[model samples]
Target: MVAFMRRRTAAALLSITGLLVLALSNPAGEWWTALQQPYQSEDLIKCAYDKCIPEGDDWFMAHLNQTIHPFLTPQSNLSAKDFLWWKKLQRDPNDLAAFKRVVDKVFQLFPEGKGFMDSGSQRCRSCSVVGNSGNLLASHNGALIDFSDCVFRMNGAPTKGYEEHVGKKTTFHIMYPESAVDLTDNRTHLMLVPFKTRDLQWLISAFTTGSIKFTYLPVKAKINANKDLVRILNPQFIKYVYEVWLRNSGGYPSTGFLGLMLAIHICDEVNVFGFGADQNGNWRHYWEELKDKTLRTGLHSGTEEYRLIQKLAAKGKINFFPGH
Candidate 1:
């Protein structure tokens, strides 16, 4: 009888040990710890727009998935299968060797590329995702956008003279080789969204060799930006945005949408600006005149994406400011 009791106790201890090991290894362990502790006002997780509820909170838990890491660090590993899947998005050639070479060079230049901006303290980190929609024209949301802790802008959206309509404060600029532009501000981080191996290669070449000037079309040979503040988005995160968030809509998520997701993951409170069409229902950028009023979102499912944005807004997940 004593031997039987001892064996049962040993099994119970082993189970507890396994549980402890899992909690330490997984990032969700923080949430588990939060669940155990008494609900204190200071201990509550504060997000950009709302304070997360203590128990049975579906909204906060659903958005915060620790498994899906959004950025690529030097230690990140990409399997051949995942690489092949990512390359197919842009129909890039099947050249894993070439891609690895570029990736290696990129990490060598930017060693500290992993992780994202997170407020470790009780302060709520707010983020503003500013798109290039024509609705931003005359919207006068410049001051409102600059109020956030971090501002994310995409592509060739210029803010030189349109400071009143679109804020001058650009914390992070998201772009690819095709939409590349010179970032005059040293404080801004150049976040490159690589769609192909050549895109990664171009990032290296732009800063160092200036050898690559074309990718399906003419690209900038050299870009004037701070290399130390450079960041590359994880391909796995792109897949997550496409499969989970977008539900495999369009060719892929637009840069603006990607910026919005990035903000959702990082910021406690998120404010979206300069999305959708102008009052005239024309899809054009705020900086340019309406040359193609009939033009629609190509490659990306703009209509569906906007619909999802509206749903998220209705759910109070994000504050969506539809520009006039």
Candidate 2:
């Protein structure tokens, strides 16, 4: 019995040691990095495609202006933080050009949204990109976020009672084949971000008979359903975002960021909320539960990508509403 007690005690000690190591490493002090460029210059570089001189070698040089000198700040100065984070990812010219192309094609996907550039009459600004978090259950923020001209939501967003949480007007619903399995409602328009070439084939198969009438925006031109509204981009764009922006740049920028950055490259002003964290830093809660909720068993509950999201939110660059 004494030996058994000793063994258990050693195991407990090891467990505590491991946990302490993780907490320190988790929000590690090392990541508080400074950028090489000034904030204003980096902002100019971020919007360089439009901000820079007309067609010159100096265009790429604008990328050099991108550095982490001034890092994350509140919402008012997030664009520069995004640019700084993006700069950390050492993108080769080929990859960078490819990403820019994706940004360009997303423009065609929603030409109405892009008209903001020419007429300057009106544009969909201040979008509240809502994530499906359980904290939103009774919080009632849907209406506020949905009132925006364009709303993008994903993953089992049960818009019935929560309509007031984010708003009932879900303009776009990003989803996958295994959609209805979740508590998904019928109002959301499905936008599939395919993980496999097989997924593309499945879309084509269903699209032919008109099982799905919604527009398709694939990285490659061939997969687009309505070539007019299809908005086919080079696969390089997805590759670049995956490699540079998502992988190399500190960590994964939530789908919200990918979509927001896409939105900003086209739209005017963007406001983001309901992303990144639970009330605590747990980072795994759902919109159906409270901020402290542990969450039901699911794939999204234990993803490294999700943890990276929490880290960015903790940095305070983005607005992550805990209780909706």
Candidate 3:
């Protein structure tokens, strides 16, 4: 009996020592974290694409900060501290109280009740981010783009005539006040990328009062969109994309880049189409004629954005279909 007790005591000591060693080795307590919170670890956390860290691509996981919420909820109120960085993009001068009033009015109408896409589920959501680059002209990606679980389009990218190239199905249409267009399909969610407090005000006014018509330039007073289906992009998310993803490369990320990042956050599989310049190296829309061959991105770093997109494709984070 004495011998057996001694052996048990020795085994307990060995186990304690092993645990101590593990604690020292993992100072961040990552192993313990993984065990306690399964699938929350960077290695185990699956994106909407149904994968965590892609093989041979540590850069993506390293840069991807999951703490950022990409959309504004009714509870997501921007404090004065957060507004300091957020206001820099569009030089918004509105105070915190003024911003809150606009936001309150917005939620009153939109009422982000629940069932947002941020919540993870067993079902895998695939997405196709369609840009308006001229490269999509000849490429017959319409069928493929529409087949995705979600299709994201930006600005005034019309799909009536170019359905053969650019898909007819638009799950989400992203735009600011200046670029806002009336959505004929009530099924499509109108995602407003609010650059300033005015943008939020515009969203409310466009749907109701139609009083706030002008920003830096004249914007549409009223927009025909489904009030229930309207969504607003979080301003903090824009700052995150600027600092973390783009590394403050451009003045700010373009609408297309923001839309792509949104897909990455919410979808299991992301497929990109209609980005970058065309074969002739002209930066023109697929539907429009090349009036100016020298046309290029002014505010945003188009070149740097394209480079990052290429790197993402090369790293296998996204399957890029560079339309011909």
**Ranking according to lDDT, highest score first:** 3, 1, 2
Q: Each model's TM-score?
A: 0.80, 0.46, 0.81
Angstrom error of the Cα, residue 155, model 3: value is 0.4
Put down candidate 1 lDDT per residue, 1-324, tens digits, no spaces: 224224433643664465467677778645334322222345323432233112134754565555767787766677777788799988898577777777888888875665465445454556789999999988887756765567899999998788777877888899999999999988789999989988988998999989998999999999999988999988878877887778899998999999998888776667899889889888888888977677899999888888878877776667789999
Candidate 3, backbone clash total: 6
Q: Is candidate 1 or candidate 2 better by TM-score?
A: 1
Q: Give model 3's TM-score versus the native structure.
A: 0.81
Q: Against the hidden true structure, what lDDT does model 2 obtain?
A: 0.40
lDDT per residue for candidate 2 within 178-280, as digits (tens), equals 4322223343334554333233343444444424333233322122223222222122333344454445443333444445444334333333555545455
Sorting all predicted structures by TM-score, with the top scorer first, yields 3, 1, 2
Question: What are the lDDT scores of the predictions, listed in order?
Answer: 0.77, 0.40, 0.78
lDDT score, candidate 3, position 70: 77
For model 3, residues 105-205, the per-residue Cα lDDT tens digits are 88988958334455454444557899989999989877567656678999989998787688688889999999999999877899999989999988989
Q: After superposition, how far is residue 86 of candidate 1 from its true place, in Å?
A: 1.1
Position 176, candidate 2: lDDT: 45
